[model samples]
Target: MKVKELMTKKVLVLKPNNTFEEAAKLFIENGIDGAPVVDKDGKLISIITKTDLMKAILNKWKMNERIETLGPKKVTTINGEMNLEDVLKYKVSRLPIIDKNNKIIGIITQTDLINNLVEKITKKYRDLKNTKLSLMELDSVIECSYDGIYITDGEGNTIKVNNAYERITGLKKEAVLGRNMRELELEGFISQSATLLVLKNGETTTIQQEFNTGVKVLVSSNPIFDKSGKIIMVVTNVRDVTQLYELKEQLQRNKEITRKYVSEIEEMRTQLLNTSEIVAEDHRTIEIIQLANRIAKVDTTILMLGETGAGKDQIAKHIHKVSKRSKKQFIKVNCGAIPTSLIESEFFGYEKGAFTGANKEGKIGLFELASGGTIFLDEVGELPMDMQVKLLRVLQEMEVVRIGGTKSIKIDVRVLAATNRDLEEMIKKKQFREDLYYRLNVVPLYIPPLRERKQDIFPLINFFLTQLNKKYNFNKVFASDALNCLYEYNWPGNVRELKNIVERVVIMSEDDKIKRLDLPKNIIGSNGMVVTLNTFEEGINLKETLDSIEGKLIKKAYDKYGNVRAAAKSLGIDPSTFVRKRQKYINNIDAQYKT
Candidate 1:
């Protein structure tokens, strides 16, 4: 209960300028121990108590003496928002309820607090007496209580229990009626009985009890004394706290998640204070983001095809973040990093002792762990043929059977697979399954390489600079020439490489401004063109040279224009013809770099 609920609102106030004689008369007539002394505007200045009035009379002070002169200049006052129980902790006889403007609104004296407590106790006594008088109607009255009520005889044997008791303890009266509390405790049905405690103490006691049915409850037991002061009955009130415990656990989890979200928001706020928004001026990039937004509502499998460091992973994370399963786990699996020997067990999990050195307890697989959420398979093209077959079955059946375990567990995981490698080409070589390729390509989102979206370079640099500057606690800005040089680079490694280069320059350079000279040697010499002439050869292979030159031109146009169709338009080449040449160029590079 709050102070406002108990405090007397019709209070007589004493002005600071009021005479002590006048204050004494008001206190006598109102029967209030104290009154708050306020200024002309009614703001509390100090309190004038009956004790102060008595002291003034004893000292033989003048009747015309100001009340403010008798009391301390400053007073401790409580706000209306304070809890009554907290206010009672202080030793003050009277407490003034002050408002936000510091004006006295109400007053609570010792008499008010005592009266409230007495009223409650009297009501409870009257109800109990009435209940005892009507023995036939006792059951109906007890059953009306929201809290579970149980009654035990002097011998600590169950006599009566309300409907709420059965629901709370999950124990029916037929099972507990006439049963001894000690016997039930020994049988492990209840952790401990409040009735047994009250019978021994012959007084009121409160105890926490956990039942065998997994219900936790707080039981308050009161012993009823007879004419000889002997315990005649033990009345216990039970309050189930199972849902309370669950709510507490959930609150703890929410607090942890809130902490993480707060940290992220702080970091984002710092970035926002330092830099502009993520740059995506390129039309293709805009279209891709829009498509991703549209596709976030669906639960279809998505295959994100892009070059390494082209923001494919970021796109996948965004999709899952905005999807319905955002609250669930988003597990990322690097298919290429897992060993061929353990791929099956890693994806499908294994039972205990399924293999040597396996965990004693069985482990859940990534798919199972990501149930009702999403599973991102990174570098999925690297999965071996054997594992590919198993993964295909999981995708088709939506279930996984643990190794050495016969039961097939159903899974409801949304698959989001990403790979820089060309799965269609791998399929042609019989390295990737054709069926798996189709299954994962239900919604393909291709992220263009960073080099192709050169407009985004400056913003990305600013973003990285803001992040790195905050990290290293340095003030750094990029020179125009340096930014131009970054724009000129072919960025084979895409945005990831740009971020690394920015960090390297920031850490290595001593100057506040990053100049072109601070850039790496390779970037300085690239001159916005692909390297063509082979140093190892004396004469250029004309066919190889022409193909290399054409590839570079196509890459440059594609970088500037964003897609094959646009690149073809800018180059004055047929869209179909440009695609064919682009494929040939890629095939040549693959052949040259193949292991």
Candidate 2:
């Protein structure tokens, strides 16, 4: 319980300027031994008590002297949010309750706590007296309970055994009622007694017991304490566990079946991704795919941030395919495609006859349609500021009211949004809502551009090539030089541009083999840059010269890209390889300086 619950709300507060006589009069009239002292602005200054006034009298202070003059200025106060038990730790008779602003709001006194505790104990005793009308009724109540009840005296002598106990233990009440628990255990009638354990420990105890009939039961014994803190009786509750053990075995079988199903489902999701043309050869891309798969199991808003054509939509689809809502609809909405005037109605739907050219029947909104499923909002950054507010509310409440409908339709849709714009900058520009941005960016997944994850480009080229081949029923292949040029050219449009280019070359080129000359002029021009070779010196070691040249190119790429992975992609090497080579050059330079 909180301190505020027990604290006296209407507390008599004295002012610091109040004289000792006035303070004494207020205390006597209110029947309070102490009162909080505050300034004119209601801020706590100190506490004045009857003791302080007595001290004032002993010091021969005049009655007109201020009460604050006699008491100590430092006072201990408890926050209203503190627990009631916190009051017990302080030795002070009265504690002032203050809010966060340090202004007195209430007061808790020792008498108030004692009175409250006494009232609770009195109520408990009254309830116990009312329940104990006759021994027959008590026996009936215990017999009606599904669990077995066994009562024993503090000395561990069984006093009573209900019908349920006989049924559970297969022992007659007459056989155990007058028997001692230790004697029963010694005679091998029962394995152990919870009553004996509780009496020995002076506390509640629970254990699994077995009877000579080979029946297992869970037993819990609670000790009843008297006024002097002496244990008077122990009540043991018994539950048959033979069926529970069987049920536990069945549950284990069910868990095994569940594991098999989960493994099969994961395999199916992998196959789904393979068919969906997702190439995850790049370490970065593979990491993103793994993260997406992990987060798909949970229902959380995900924001896919990437450049245009970076396969954000594909990742969103992959997440849906692996999610628990895989069997349900995966609705995709292009926020940028919808017209501004019709955006709200298109997203939220509208009631019949609510607007001009409205559908005759009331339409279900995208959120409602995707209920128990997933919704993909592509180009989410393009949504208007006003629409962002509505979207944020729908996400927050998980419900939406149609454009012209008064009732809110509850939804259980998982939101997956993708954007190619800088939402943080947009928020600063007031083009987007900051709250909406944070709601959508709960789990942000950034897909690296094609240039940054160049290793995946070749696999994606093959994937799209094979797909287009099967679709068009044509046999086409790219020559080694053409492939090299394609790999060398930077794809600003990311995966989408790569797929389009592959399709274009496969369809446009007449030859069976796509040669370097058949490639796009831009691709060739971008890859045609030449390197300048320095004049060869007589003492130049061929390997050392080549190493120096490689080091310079690596350093240049690293400096320009400012990212290890991207720089490695530019150098056509792995990130680990880049790091190793960079360290190697540094070590060589240090060794040269040492020499």
Candidate 3:
């Protein structure tokens, strides 16, 4: 608080020429200990206190001596805006308050300072009381939280434990409270104490703490510090993730089962989806495949870019099958799917007895296995930094070195990388090496998303339909209305989502044809209605009809592609034209709405 709020007003002042006797009389009359001595212009000169007056009286000082001479020739005066902290730094009991004119405005005495301190202490007490009341109100929420909570002091002594903490750890609050984390750990109440770690290091820590009762909890401990940069408290949030881990394990098991089923189905479909005969009816798709074919003629690194489910894998496979090394082995590796710990051994084989549980006769790695062929690295952005360095070295040296072997074996293999992620962004973030990215991105090709290539959607749907019919011996067709919905709906998951939907419709439809009712709501509600030409009674206005057709095509493209640029690309029109036409239709809709 500012000193002005506590400084005493109506301050008694003495002229610089005032005698010691006059000062003493004024001090007694005002019942004050001190007063400011100022000159005729009302500017502060010095200060005289009761001690100075009494000392002068005993010594019988001369009357000619000015009151300013009694105490100090120069005195410290503070501005009204100065804070209490600044005031305390001065070692005097009485101080004069001054304004911009250097005139004495008021005085701060010892009694005033004491009173202000008492007021501050009372306010602090009230604030602390309010804080306690607020904490009491939120006690129920803390107890009801799904995650367990525990708080400890800087000394690692437990202060509070929530109900969830007791419930998850099977320990009573009484047993845990008043006992420090180290004590609890020694007693085997908790296998580990993250709170202790936070207290020691003063940093937030997350750890899995196991209890002697066989329950595992994920705990995150955060240290709260005071203004002095010292830890005052540690708050730990604990969650019983045993069930979560179990659920993840079950999901992995289900994923394995699904993988086996999909593998079998893909093996069967491989006979039909010949690498040389991939469906590429759209001009853009045909152009991309031709580029891939040219890149495949040689054995240089190739990078494929596209959205997930946009058939990046299909492009990689086509490149591998058409390359000069097509007669040799073709190995596909999903960099993201492998664990970081096992990725090195997976890429380069380990020698026999290299480490514990090593293969007796050693095993061949992907680089060794695909010595004379191509190895496709799918989702290559997930490679760790160390592995990226090793992979780059292998690429540059054209050889392989086993984990335990000292000698490098020379090899001849082509590398192809593909990722849905933006490797350029990853390179900027330092997550992916720029050198490795350049090596892999030697011949980069990007395949447009399914929505941008709507012309190819019907072809893909028909191909899946033919294959599904042949495999299941069913001749199912889609109705006109259903086909319209499928065309209007944007394929976010691209060809994979389209193929899955087609297969599901084929299997679920009881009738020979799939109707609008059989399609998913997303597809049916993608757009309000199919835009069709309406016949007029007299005749069609050529200009108006053409405008209407142009506007409808622009709107349809925008609806399917979700942007003017992609829509323009799909319709082979300029983005500006697409934007203008789309805006005209939007204005027409808005005007109709207002009316």
Candidate 4:
């Protein structure tokens, strides 16, 4: 080590112009006996001490006089780059340290070197003491161990055996110690020897051995190597595992029983889902429902994707009802319904008096209210960009910080988000964050539109009709022709539209039976196979009636073919004309149904 490493870098340097009183005050305040003196150009001149100051005081010298007049001009100094051993050769208690330019950089005292020497000596002593104790404890630990410990020489001669070995093998140390393992095995004292195997292979070995006394033991032998890579000794650990084998067989039986119980529980859950409000007669819908049920057992985020009124909300609620958190609260929030300016406060809540017109007791955010439960974010795609960042943080950290509050509240909430908008496309357009999209889309569930799952239409219609009849205290039924039209019509609005139509016909029909004529005009025009003069008996315009019929036929072809070119060809028209007529009809439909 060098002197610079041990020296104190912050050194007090006195100047020739400083008064004796000033030098004395610095020495007293800093708890130092001496300091280096420098000239005006900061060159080391000498060193001064309290003894020199006291001698000057005894001589009745003025306290305001310069300190340079009292201290000796000659002083000892050392270079910072010099070895630390050179410091010991000096007679002085304190030495001023200088750089290559002979300028004082630091100061070193004899006590610093002494203290460093003492620290090194103390550490070495502590290490030796710990090593000695460890070796003593190792021997005691081996002797007191529950498992048998047997040691043999490289030549397979028994060297030592702990009390546990004697007790487990039913052999005393006097009978086994110093005996060759081959002789013991040939004499019928043991069935086999793990130590002999280790000596032959020069590696660790294990085997099960049976003693003549009918005691069974499992032994593992590990070889100890010398510096020349030759085995010096083999240490064997013996354990009694006869009871362990029996316990393993019992454990296998228990696992089989547990599996049977799990299968029964799963069957019960499946039955519960079938009895719920979700109608899953179609194969694709049934598969989706099964997947939702399986994932509901855990706390994973699920994103429901489908067209508007496709029962996305119903699926989200179903997930919550079947989840582990079913007993807890299920809070639903429409991201699009909340105002953008107040979204942050509404999501993370706020402290009392956070802003103007705030509630006096503050408010709990949706996340906090749904802690230990579930939160369904409907229309999640409509969240603002800024709120998306905050939501991502909450999901990642599982905690939320309220507005105007410093403390972060921990929450255990499972998130289920549903959106009619395409979030992946929104990510490409820079409207949604890619990372947030991945978090919410851990499990993507797509609910098919009503047109795709026609098998479910009749069941859902009957369900709605029954519900409406019960509410109105009247019995209502749909005619066969009406049910056929509903099944054939391409429902653009999905389940929500079907429910509304069912309720409308049930209440407005003049008789108990709802016939095909009682259905909506749009539905009849779209699905009716034959147009009769009786259909116009209610007094319709000639031009409007003809235009409506033509538009419905074009739409029907487009729905069947699913492409502009093929749909137009089927109707004996050009693709361009098909596009034009489709756009016009869509506009007219929107205008006519604006209520």
CA RMSD of all predictions: 28.7, 30.7, 32.1, 31.5
lDDT of 1 by residue, 317-430 (tens): 878877899999999987755656777887889999888888889787888999999999997987878788899999999999998899999999999999987788779888
Q: Distance from true position, residue 525, model 1, in Å?
A: 1.3
lDDT of 2 by residue, 1-595 (tens): 4434544534344443445456546654664444444433324444444432212223232333342342333323344343344444432234344444545454433334333433543343344425544444565787798989987766776656778889888997656755789999999999998888888888889999999989999999998776667776788999999899989999999999999998996685466455465877777887888788899999989999998778898999999988999999999997755666777887888899888888989788888899999999997976877899999899999988997789998899999999877888777878789999899999999988889998998899888889878988989998999999999988866777777678778877998899998876657884432334755446656665577677678768865764455677888887667767764552333233223
lDDT of 2 at 245: 91
Model 4, 405-447: lDDT tens digits are 8999999999999987778777998888999999999999998
lDDT of 2 at 54: 19
Better of 1 and 2 by TM-score: 2
What's the lDDT for all of these models? 0.71, 0.72, 0.71, 0.72
TM-score of every prediction relative to native = 0.43, 0.44, 0.43, 0.45
Task: Indicate the worst ten consecutive residues by lDDT in candidate 1.
Answer: 52-61
Compared with the true structure, what per-residue lDDT tens digits does model 3 show for residues 1-595? 4334534443344454445456556654664444444433334444454332122222332333443343343333344343444345532344344444544454433333323433533343244325553333455667778889997767887756788888998887767665779999999988889999998887999999899888988999998776578776788999998898899999999999999998985664453345644776677887787787788888889888987678888888888887788889889997755666778889999899888898999878889998998899987876878999999999999998998999899999999988877788878878789999998899898989989888888888888889988988999988888888898888876877787778777877889899988875556774433334563445546665566677678767765754445678899976656655654553332233223
Best by TM-score: 4
Candidate 1 clashing pairs, residues 3+ apart or interchain: none
Instruction: Arrange candidates by TM-score, descending.
Output: 4, 2, 1, 3
What is the lDDT ranking, best to worst? 4, 2, 1, 3
Decide which is better by TM-score, 2 or 3: 2
